[model samples]
Target: MASHSLSAVRKRRRRRAKTLLVMVGLLLLTGAGGYLALLNLEPSEAVMRERCTAVVGTETYDLNPDQASNAALIAGVALRRGLPPRAASIAIATAIQESGLRNLDYGDDAGPDSRGLFQQRPSQGWGTQAQVMDPIYAANAFYDGLLKVPGYTNMPITEAAQAVQISAFPEAYADHEPEARAFASALTGYSAASLDCMLRSAESPGDPSQVAAAAAAVFGNQSVVVNESTVTLQAVDRAGWATAQWAVANAKQLNLTSVSFGGLQWDRVGGWTSAETEPGTVTLNVAGAVVE
Candidate 1:
């Protein structure tokens, strides 16, 4: 009787052990399946590539890559200045005329007093030599004075710039307006992605990531990501879901990630990650600072 009882106890233990092993295997399989689903959830690369191509072909001026980059810089500066798309267009057109969007180290004799991207004169109250050289500051100053002029927006590009710049060669800005308008139209939408550089160069002082964060603060928790060489931002609605289907849809132009909705609030969870630890899974929380 004692031997039979012992045999039954051993059989129960073996069954429990087998059951536990099966459960663990099932759990691991489920976890792996979930991860694969997440990976597959990312937007199609081919689609993104096509969209990027369209943006480059349509929005950019016929100038070479250097000129396109310069145009983007000017647009970014104008956007930072809180200028409307029209105002940015006018500014770019003026720069195209003044320096062909190239930041010339030397000023032409026609405007020896002219300098920097906009060619504002230091002798004029535009600013000290240092201030005018800084594109953001100079552009903001120009827009500030430009906005104060009566009917500046309604006036021609030359008139608008001359109202602020008081340039002797007022008509020089007129020819550049069409190119500027083309740039503005391409960059002002929600679906409009980041402007690409024909030539890669050193990073600018005004990084687009910082700009996107500022825009998000005013606009709500929009998704910002660095894709290829461009910084993309997607606009989200009150629920934080992406409102546009693609990057070329809205007027507040920025690159964007594929839309995600109904997931755990990613912002609260923190930024994305590829870790396997608990609490390290992809969540919306802001990324924590790393130690040096």
Candidate 2:
């Protein structure tokens, strides 16, 4: 009777052991399946974070796509006017302090009629309300004010910005000097390959005509050629680098796949890399377009 009882006990123990192993295997399978599902459903954190950066020397400054776009436009205007990089730095600094590089349609209590990038007031002879709200007009208007300042380039950033803006907070412009200078240098073609944009895949097809128009708006009449999905501009040396970096800065909005110039190429997935291309030309390829 004792031997029979011991045999029954051993059988029960073996069944429990098998059940435990089965549960463990099932749990492992479920965990693996969940992981795969997560991978398919969501993008990694790194991939989702989109930003543009300007690395100057040992310091790096960052801006979101919107800010970068505005900064690029501001710098482009300076380039078109043949202003030095210092002028761009001061203009950008004023924009930073005034509207945070964004084109605002509203204004604060001090300047109730203020609008646009430099917070220029329509009442103060900056321009009409509609004109100040237009970024291109606003940028030109800001530069108009800036040019009136005697020896603006020789003045400190705060003093220069204050002279143009005539803001109540004069000292505040100094705070953005470093950031403004970095972006101005990169966008003005003084710093080569110093700007990079990490962005997600383009959401829609890009229009070549739009790209051509934007280039014309900022850089003025350029030798722009459009062939299928590619737009090539005749730019070289510092201007070439400037055009290339500007394309990178505006890539997110333009839905550009790649910008190549001066023996360097930039893409959304892999920042800037080396590639051989014709000299004295900057090539921009728009996204979601068939190359014919």
Candidate 3:
């Protein structure tokens, strides 16, 4: 009887070991499969980030897509209205102070009625809340007030901005002068090849109507052309670069793959290239974009 019991015990231990081995094998296989799945996923399947930069001389300014886009519009509007580079700098500084270059519809307890990029108070004749929310309108309104300050272009940025903004924190605008200057120089075409954006993923493609409207909203009527596969803009030399760079600044959002003018072209993977192209018109090629 003792011998028989020993044999049975040995058999039971062998069976348990086999079962544990099978489980360990299964676990290893499962882990390997999961890791392989992760490796197979596309880069764009993950949330991708976009960035823009303005490099001028020895200075560089980096900003997110939204901030870059807004900065472009602010400076573009300044150019469209014949505002000097100094005016653009002061405007950009003021925007940096008020809303961090974003258009906001709310304000602090002191000026709860204040709104827009410049934090203009609707109750204080800055126009309707809706107008204040419009970046172009608000920028124009800011310029209107800014122009009223005598020789604002020649005044110190903080003092000029203070006269227009009348902020309780008047000196805050001074801190952003360097960054604002870099962005303004690039967007206003005073600094060539100074601005660019690295888009991490392909975005929704460009829309003809929307592109035209967006450009018109800032540059004012007929500065850009609406087309099925292209949006042409009337840019002369550096002005062309300003618009091309603006398209690049908006590439991620607009799914812009190509911005071409003169003998140069900017594409998604490779940046600017020397491509033979027509003069007098800057063509932005809109291929493989989501039209929405």
Candidate 4:
């Protein structure tokens, strides 16, 4: 009887092992099917590859969407304050060195209380922790410090940045000078059609009012025409390009489908191409709507 019971237990264990093997096989097959489905995804369902580039002369600088957005805000603030492109360059370099143009919520050992894009420390009277974490406030504060530095516009990018930042590794700012200058030149409208963002298709319809409000926040009140899914900012010359490029830098967050100015159009897939857009207007179109 004991021998028969032991044999029964062994048979039951073998059946369980067989069941586990079948389950593992099914899991592997399911995983492969999912991968195959991903491989055959439609163009409309392609994964997002979002990035922006600033190309000026022989130099080209690439920034991920978040960094590009922050860089745009910094340059826009400089434009609003009537500061020169040099000021934007200095500010961009400093931000790149200190925070890689990201609005960080924490700090390193050098500035245990630092926050935001420029890493302004609350302990040093930059602002309250909440205020320092605000990108707009942080950018304005950095510009305020830059403006206080006499002859900053004429100083080398590193020196100008160091004068305002007083960073421990002052020389690090110089390393980002080329990248900063390229972005500044394109964003400031000194180089037309020099900034482009390659992004995935917009996920949903975008709000034109929000775009207009953001543009106004950066470039001040302007002649704006709003349609179903488009907003035309009546700015000409370099200013038009500045507004257009600013829209491009912000395209990811704004869900912008296209930005056209000075007879050039930048769309999500086609990049920059010649268009019939008027020279004196910067027209922005959002996704999933008719654009007039």
Report lDDT (CA) for all predictions. 0.51, 0.88, 0.79, 0.86
Model 4: CA > 4 A from native: 1-48, 289-292
* Cα lDDT tens digits for candidate 4, 1-292: 9999999999999999999999999998788667646444334445556789999777777999889889999998888788899998998898898888998999965588999899899999899999988888898999999889999888988898888888899899999999999999888888999998988667557999999998988888899998878999998887888889999999879989999999999997737999999769999997754321
TM-scores of the candidates are 0.50, 0.84, 0.81, 0.84
* 1 or 2, greater by TM-score: 2
Candidate 2 local Cα displacement, residue 203, angstroms: 0.6
Candidate 2 TM-score over all chains jointly:
0.84
**Residue pairs in steric clash, candidate 4?**
none
- List ranges where model 3 is wrong by over 4 Å: 1-48, 287-292
True-vs-predicted CA distance for residue 104, candidate 3, Å: 1.2
Q: Write the per-residue lDDT of candidate 2 for residues 1-292, one digit (tens) a residue.
A: 9999999999999999999999999998788668645443234432477889998899999998899999999999999999999998998888888898999999965488989888888888888999999998888888888899999889999998888787899999999999999999999999999999988667677998899888888999999998778899999899998898889999989989899998889998647899998899999999873322
The residue pairs in collision within model 2 are: none
Ranking by lDDT: 2, 4, 3, 1
**Two-way TM-score contest, 1 vs 3, winner:** 3
Q: Candidate 1 lDDT, tens digit per residue, 227-266?
A: 3333445433321222211111211133222222323221
lDDT of 3 by residue, 132-250 (tens): 99998998998899889998877889999999888888888899999999988888888766777766435454676777777778777656667787889887876777777777777
